[model samples]
Target: MEKKKELENLLVSVSENDDYAFRVFYDLYYRSVFRFAYYFLRNREACGEVVSNVFVAVWKSRVALRRIENIDAYLYVVARNEANRYLKESRTRRRCLSFEEIPISLIDRNSPPPQRRRSR
Candidate 1:
C-alpha cells in the first residue's frame, strides 16, 4: 500500500477507537517523535515524558486525527509544544524549590538563553 493511503486508513481506524490501529501508528512515529523532542530536551527521562505526553494528546484527540492532512507535521508540532511546556514547568518548579532540590539534568542547556527585549 502507498504510504499516504496507509496513514489515512490508520487515522480513520484510530478515530473509530481501534486500539490496534493506534498501536501501529504509535510504533510508526514513536522514534521520530522521541528524537524530535530530544533535540529540545537533552535528558532521556524528560524526553521520555514528552513522548508519553504527546501520545496521550494524540489519543485524546483521535477523533480529529482523520482531518489532519499531514500527520508527521502535526506530530512534530505537538512534540515541540510539549517539550516547551515541560521546560516551562521545570523552570517554575526550580523557582519554587531550592536549586539543590531539582536534579541537574533538568536544566536544558541546549535551549538558547532567553533574549531580553529592548525597550525604547
Candidate 2:
C-alpha cells in the first residue's frame, strides 16, 4: 500500500538519523501508541510516560528500523510492555513505602512539636 511505502521511506531516513523523518515517524505513531498504552494503564500520566519511553526506545534502536516488518505492531508491543513495566514498578514502590519497619526518624524533621494539655 502507499502508506506502507511512505512509512518504509520514513523509517529508512530515520535509520540514517534524519531528524525530520524521525519527527514524521513519531507524529504518525504517537497518538495510536498513547491510546494503546492508555487502554492498558488506565492512567493519563502513566500512559504519557509509556508513550514517551516507547518512542525513546524506537529512536535509540533506529538502526534496526529496517528490519521491522510492521511498525504499528512494533509500537503497540513496545507500548504494552512499557505500560506493564510501569505498573509493576509502581506496585513495588507502593509496597516498599508501606512497610511497617520504616523508621520514624526518617519522617520530616521540621514539623511543629505536639502541644500539651493545659487542663489540670
Candidate 3:
C-alpha cells in the first residue's frame, strides 16, 4: 500500500510533465512489465518491442496519467494487448503470401486463353 501511494504521487508529478517523476516511474515498472510481456510472447524481440511500446504510450499520455487508477494494472493490460496484437499480426503475415513471393515456376505460362463466343 505504501508503494502504491508512492507510485500514485509519482504519477501525479508525471502528469505535470515532470521528467524526474517519469524517469522514476519508468525505472520502477520497466523490468516487471518486460517480464510480464516475456512470459506471454516468449520471444525476446517481441517482448522488447512490447515493453518499449508500453512505456512510450505512458510517456505520450503522461498528461492523463492522473486519470489512471492503477498504474501496474494499466501497464500489464497494455503489455498483454501489445503481445496479442503482435502475435496475431505475425500469424496473419505468415499466412499471406504477396504476389512477388509466389514462385514463377508454379504459374502456367503455356495456358491458352479462352476464346469469347460470338454473340447470337
Candidate 4:
C-alpha cells in the first residue's frame, strides 16, 4: 500500500519532467520490461532493442505517466508491442528474397518457358 502510494508520487514527479525521478523509475522497472520483452523475443540482441524502445517510449510519454494506473502493466504492454513489432519485421525479412538470393536461371530472360504437363 505504501509502496504503491510512493510509486504514484514518483509517477507524478516523472510526469513533471524530473530527470532524477525518471532515472529512478527506469532503474526500478528496466529489468521487468527487459524480461517481459525477452519472453517474446528470445534473442538477446532483439530483446535489448525492445528494451531500449520501451524506455524511449516511457521517456517520450512521461507527461502521461501520472494518468497510468498500473505502471507495471503499462511497461509490459509496451515491451510486448515492441517485441511483436520486431517479430513481424523479422518475418517480413524472411519472406522477402534478396536480389543475390534469386537463382541465376530465374534471372535468365531468354530461358525457355516452363512446360506445362498435358492432361491425361
Candidate 5:
C-alpha cells in the first residue's frame, strides 16, 4: 500500500476512535517528527519530548481537527511549532542567565593586583 494512503487511513481511524490506527500512525511518523524537532532543539531528549508533546496535542485535538489535505504536512507543522516554542524558551533562559548582566560589584575584588605579586 502507498504511504500516503496509509497515513490518511490512520488519521481517519484517529477520528473514528481506533487505538490500533493511532499506534500505527505513531510508528510511521515518530522518527520524522523527531528529526524535524531536532533541527530546533539540537538535543535528542528535547527533540523526543517535543515530538511526543506534538502527538499528544494532535490526539487531543482530533475531535475538532478539520479536513487536512495532507497528514504529513499537518504533523510537520505541529512539530515545527512545538520545536520553535521550545527553542524560544531555551533562548530566553540563556539570555536571562547571562553573566554579563550581573553587577560589576558582585565580582571578587579582594584579589591582589598582578603587579604586587612576588616572584615565585
Candidate 6:
C-alpha cells in the first residue's frame, strides 16, 4: 500500500513538471514493465523495445498524466495495448492460416489423388 502511494506521489511530482522525479518513476517501473511486455511479446528484444517506447511516451506526457488514478494499471494497459498492436502488425500473412483458404491441392500434391469408389 505504501509503495503504491509513493508511486502515485512520484507520478504527481512528474506531472507537476518536476522532471527529476521521472528518474524515480523510471527506476520503480522499468523492469516490471519490461516483464509485462515480455508476457505478451515473448521476444526479449521486441518487449524491451516496446517497454522503452512506452516509458519514453509516459515521460513526455507526464504532465498530462496527473489525472491517472493508478499509474501501474495505466502503464500496464498502455504496454499491453502496444504489445498486442505490435504482434498483430508483425504477424506474417502466410502463417495466418485460414480454414477456408486451405490448399486443396496440398492433399493431392504430396500423394496420389484419392480414388473415389462408385456406388451402384
Q: Cα RMSD to native, each candidate?
A: 11.5, 6.2, 8.5, 4.7, 5.5, 7.7
Give the lDDT of residue 2 in candidate 3.
Answer: 100
Q: Per-residue CA lDDT of candidate 5, range 28-109, in tens?
A: 8898899888877889988988998999988998864447777778888999999988888888987784587765555657
> Backbone clashes per model, in order?
0, 0, 0, 0, 0, 0
At residue 54, candidate 3 shows an lDDT of 90
At residue 107, give the lDDT of candidate 3.
65
- Superposed model 6: Cα runs more than 4 Å off: 1-5, 92-120
lDDT of 6 by residue, 1-120 (tens): 997777778878998878689887888789999999999888998998899888878978888787888777889998998898778777866477787776666545877665779999
- Judged by whole-model lDDT over C-alpha atoms, candidate 2 comes out at 0.88
The global C-alpha lDDT for each of the candidates, from Candidate 1 onward, is: 0.94, 0.88, 0.87, 0.90, 0.80, 0.83
Residue 25's lDDT in candidate 4: 92
> How many times do residue backbones clash in model 2?
0
Q: Model 3 TM-score? A: 0.78
- The count of residue-pair clashes in candidate 5 stands at 0
- Top candidate, metric lDDT: 1
- Candidate 3 residue 37 C-alpha distance from true site, Å: 0.6
- Candidate 2, residue 76: the lDDT equals 87
The TM-scores of all predictions, comma-separated, are: 0.79, 0.81, 0.78, 0.80, 0.70, 0.67
| Candidate 4 lDDT, 38-120, residue by residue in tens | 88888889988989999899989999999999888899888888999999999999999999998666898888766779999
The worst-scoring run of ten residues by lDDT in candidate 4 lies at 105-114
Q: How close is candidate 6 to the true structure, as a TM-score?
A: 0.67
The collision pairs in model 4 are: none
Regions of model 2 farther than 4 Å from truth: 98-120
Model 1 TM = 0.79
The TM-score, computed over Cα atoms with residue i paired to residue i, of candidate 5 is 0.70
Q: Which stretches of candidate 4 lie over 4 Å from their true place?
A: 111-120
Lowest lDDT block of 10, candidate 1: 102-111
Model 4 per-residue lDDT at 53:
92
